[model samples]
Target: MLSPSPNSSKKAFSRVALVGKFHADGIEDHLKDLATLVSGLGCEVFIEAETATHLGLSGYPTKTAQDFAGSIDLVVVLGGDGTMLGIARQLAGSNVPLVGINMGRLGYMTDIPFQSVKDTLPKIIAGDFEADTRTLLDAVVLRDGKEINRALALNDVVVNRSGISGMVELAVQVNGSFMYNQRSDGLIVSTPTGSTAYALSAGGPILHPHVAGILLVPIAPHSLSNRPIVLPKHSVTVIEVVNGLEVIVNFDMQSQTNLQSGDKIEVRQSDKTIALLHPSNHSDYKTLREKLHWNEYPSTF
Candidate 1:
């Protein structure tokens, strides 16, 4: 585990929000402790509406994640990676900086573990943490070359079928150049930050968040030669539905839309970026080895 950054030399007043899985045991206690910890550092702590009810603290009187992001100076997410992703997608257009505190197993985005809260809190409250900015993707679906639906994803945009009969065929292209006509259950266009998510499950490469690239990995490719490819971050990729099969498009984990044959999805780097509060970015390779146990050696001595 990484150590926390030290507290800031100057005091600062900031609005902070806590997003957590209050259903988890001991989390309420931790929330209270965390709130008090930051409050003592001259920051105002805010809670989500229902989460406050669960914790018996003051309800925030708001429901949407945008409410918190639009109001606060910083957002603190105390759950697993899923929770952080959920919050990230919700606050996508709002451009909120997120600080993820891990309360679950195998958290890559949620770097600060529950045990490290005491050390991490003081520094984060004092604005001593490092900030890593990760860009998002803007994905829009079109039918007959007419606009239909649009969404933003911090992770990846997935196009898949719920049916079981035949594989979904996707015509993949990058900036008007044909990549391949792929036959698979789905297609994943993931950001480097998302390389560890569903893309990784589909045999995609693990890309560092700082890497300026996007990944297109096929899910169960029909041809043996179809391999995952990384594209320049600024490249515009296009995917069209083929094979006359019905499919669904997902923006990160939210916003699902149905697409028929001839529907097109254009993906590219979103103009905005998401800022992450980091204790340090010096050792993600270490995280890959330690937290994930990437490639361990047997006793050689």
Candidate 2:
């Protein structure tokens, strides 16, 4: 249970949007229930177009993620962290706050459980919640000195070999300063918000979400001396494939693009931020303890 912040006023969320993972089991029912709940709170509900189509729903107004930019006040995401990450990237720079309802194995970003949605959402609607602003990374891929593709990520920008099963050479630089040249499977450039995701699995440090730093973790480095390094939030990192063998750049594990030998992948902090709403009782340490199964003892103790 969460109590409203002392300074929070009873501001209502009039326009809300519902987004969920496509084809997820039981997602239709959850979407229907959430729409009804939001309507009961005297708010208008808009469902994402793809989600509506998957659920066979038509009555409620449907809007594309991009179309909801100025119209939707808040977006309620139902699924795992991956689902939330997808929505977060779409809603980036829109300044729309996101509320996650957990329906996955590990729900780090999606803190609210499905059973608690009915209770938790109402409080959030009444402006009785806390907002945690997280930084986003802007990743751009340059080929032949021309901008090829760009995307925003809430987690990390990974540069790895695509089809070939061998190590690729990558020369890394930070703000024009040479960092290192490594032969490895890949490199994970993560924001603090992404420290616990793939970065942690690659032996990177677990950075608190509030930490103002970016992490560089090499994936399967050939040399044991290569280690994770944390850089300032404002620093720009450029990774050039020195000896590319069909490489690729992945953004938050949601979108990816193939890279060439001379391709340059630049990662930097974006000016936009994501506002994540959480219950007042939310604790990062508790989430870590439960999700990671840490410090559990035997019953006889």
Candidate 3:
């Protein structure tokens, strides 16, 4: 769960779209069940094109992920965080809030559980939900001061070395000011929404979603003093590859682009954002305790 916005007048969602993790087991049956339920609520139900094709579902009208903007009132994603990340990026800045029904392990972003979606989704569809807006990272690859590649990431932008390569050397700068030069396996520039993800796994601190900051975490730094740091939300970070072979830059680990020496990766907070809708009862702290297993200890102690 994310920190929820204030409760507002519930807006009726008459048009709803469903996206599923087609690779997940039993997805077809789950989508069918949801379609029936949405229809029962007197709403028009649509299936995302790729999802429909994979499941061989043809009974419902199909739309591309891009087409869902301005067309659907709400989008329901039935998958894990990976699936949600993909759709969230596609729908970023669209103002079409997304609801996630978790069907994967360690669902940090996909907080809603499938077992409870039956009892929960109806309320959300009727506008009884909390909305949380998350910022996005816009990154571009620069070679000879020319833009070569660009992408938006809902999580962190990672600059890493290949499997067979040793530590890469990166020169870091913030807002055009020199920061540091370091040799490490990689570097992670993460948003608060991604603080709990790969950044955390790389020894980065877990920042609350509402926190206004960006995280920089080094992976296997050659110098022990090269630790993680948090930058102001408005700051722009630039990392130049001064050394290493097969270096690459990844946007949320979903997409990747090979990097060469002297190539600069420029990252900044995007003007756009993703809006996530949650059950009214959602609590960020409670979710952390549950998903991160903070509840494993004796509560009575």
Against the true structure, whose TM-score is highest?
Answer: 3
How well is each residue in 135-164 modelled by candidate 1, as lDDT tens digits?
788999999989899888889999888777
Residue runs of model 1 more than 4 Å from their true location after superposition: 1-9, 53-64, 68-70, 93-95, 244-246, 295-301
Candidate 2, which ten residues in sequence have the lowest lDDT sum? 1-10
| Per-residue C-alpha lDDT of model 3 across residues 169-288, encoded as one tens digit per residue | 999999999999999999999999999999999999999988999999999898999999999999999999999999999998899999999999999999999999999998888788
| Order of models, best TM-score first | 3, 2, 1
lDDT of each: 0.79, 0.89, 0.89
Candidate 2: stretches off by over 4 Å: 1-11, 296-301
Error of 2 at 252 (Å): 0.8
Off by over 4 Å in 3: 1-11, 104-106, 296-301
lDDT of 1: 0.79
| lDDT string, candidate 2, 126-188, tens digits | 887889999999999999889999999999999998776689999999999999999999999
Error of 2 at 253 (Å): 1.0
Give every collision pair in model 1. Answer: none
